[model samples]
Target: MKTPNAACPCWSGLAYEKCCQPLHKGGEAPTPEVLMRSRYSAYKLGLVDYIMKTTHPDGPRFQADTAAWKHDIEAFSKHTHFAGLQILSASEDKVMFRATLFANSQDVSYTEISVFRQHNGHWKYFSGAHLDP
Candidate 1:
């Protein structure tokens, strides 16, 4: 759990309030990379509603069972350690990054290129393609 003044969980080098809080508080992320970093911070903070709201409904990863999906996300967030994030690249709609993590003291880090799409007027997480670490 991080306070508003604590370092951002996204490893953005900015405090939580200055970095992800605004986005969590209904501000829109201007780009996919920003949204992805905020999503990582959301995961670290266990902000499940933000995760749910930011996921693209039309994307393949959008789970229809809201209750189950929220539960799964909560479980993961509680059990996993969000160790670090490294942005590899960013285009107009895709952001590639490596998320270093640990679960049950076992390393579970991964690199991923996340895709985003604009739905209505806001950018939403669409999908992710995992890469070998």
Candidate 2:
């Protein structure tokens, strides 16, 4: 668990309270890049509800089985180490990032370009294409 003054898990250099905390506490992200960073932080913090709520309902990643989906997310969050995040590029509706991660002492890092869509004027994660899979 992180204190309010600790650095954010998003690699944004800002305090958690100044950065992703607002997003996790029901504040809307103003841009796709911000949303993407916040999502990474949410995973680090095991905020399952935030991840589910920010996922686009019609997107490919959106599973109908909420219980199973939440369980999977929780399991992943528990096992994985969120090492770092680097934004490679970002457009109005897309963000490319390199997620540095480790699980079971094995490197599971990957570069992914993610798509976002506006749902009720707030950004929602739509899909992701791994560039290094």
- What are the models' TM-scores? 0.98, 0.98
What lDDT tens digits, residue by residue, belong to model 1 across residues 7-114? 999999999999999999999999999999999999998999999999999998799999999999999999999999999999999999999999999999999999
Q: Write the per-residue lDDT of candidate 2 for residues 76-129, one digit (tens) a residue.
A: 999999999999999999999999999999999999999999888889999999
Backbone clash total for model 1 is 0
Worst window of 10 by summed lDDT in candidate 1: 1-10
Q: Stretches of candidate 2 above 4 Å error? A: none
Q: For all the candidates, what are their Cα RMSDs to the real structure? A: 0.7, 0.8
**Superposed model 1: Cα runs more than 4 Å off:** none
TM-score of 1: 0.98
